[model samples]
Target: MDDAIIRRHLSVGRLTILEVLHDEPGIDEDQLLAEWIRRRPPASQAHARRLPRTIAQLLWQLRNLEWVDDTEGELTITALGEYVREFARLHSPSPFASRTSTVGGHSA
Candidate 1:
C-alpha cells in the first residue's frame, strides 16, 4: 500500500477503480461499470460503454490482489485498497500527466 508498492503495480485504470471503491463503498458491478465509465476520459467512455461484460474481469483482478471485496453483489475497498488509493492521490503524479514538460533542465 505504500508508494513503492503502488508505483510498481500502478495503472491509471486500476488506480481509478480503487479510488471509486473508496468513495462509493458497497457499489454493485453494474453501478461500478457505469461509474467507472463516467469517470473515464471522454474518448474511452465510448469504448468502455460497450464492454459491460468485462466488468467481472476487472473486478476479478482487484479481488485476486486482495484490494477489493465483492459480497452479495456489493463492492468495497479493503484497508490495503484504501491505502493504495490515498497513496496514489497524495504521493503519485498523474500517470497521464504531460511528462513532456521540462524538469531540472531535462524533459520529463
Candidate 2:
C-alpha cells in the first residue's frame, strides 16, 4: 500500500473513478459517470437522486488531490492516480478492491 494512496482516504467511488480514468484516459465526465454508475449503481431511488452530486464531489476531491485532471471536458488519471490504482490492485483481496478491505491488516 502506498502512503500517498493511503493518505488520500479513497472511497470505492473515488477508486472506481481512478480505475476508469486509468483505463480510458480521455473519457468525458458523462462517460466516466455512466461507467461508474453501471459498475456501482446507487443503493436506492433516493441514492440515485443523490448519485450525481456525490460523484461530482468525489471527482472534485480527486482533482484537488491532483489524482485526476479534466481538460476540455475530458478526464485523465495522473501518475499519482496510477500509483494508487496499482496499490489497490495489488492489495485488494478481491477484484475491484473495496475501500473496506481488511486484508493484510489494512483497512481504508
lDDT of 1 at 55: 62
* TM-score for each model: 0.73, 0.79
For this target, which candidate reaches the highest lDDT against the unseen true structure? 2
Cα lDDT, model 1, residue 64: 79
| Per-candidate count of clashing residue pairs (backbone under 3 Å) | 0, 0
lDDT of 2 at 70: 86
* Model 1 bad stretches (over 4 Å): 1-3, 41-46, 96-108
Encode model 2's per-residue lDDT on 60-96: one tens digit a residue. Answer: 8888878899888889999887877777678665634
Candidate 1 per-residue C-alpha lDDT over 1-108 given as tens digits, one digit per residue, 9 for 90 to 100: 455545666556566678788889999988888787677644565665665655677678788778889899889999988876776677645644532322122221
lDDT of 2 at 32: 82
Q: Which stretches of candidate 2 lie over 4 Å from their true place?
A: 1-8, 95-108
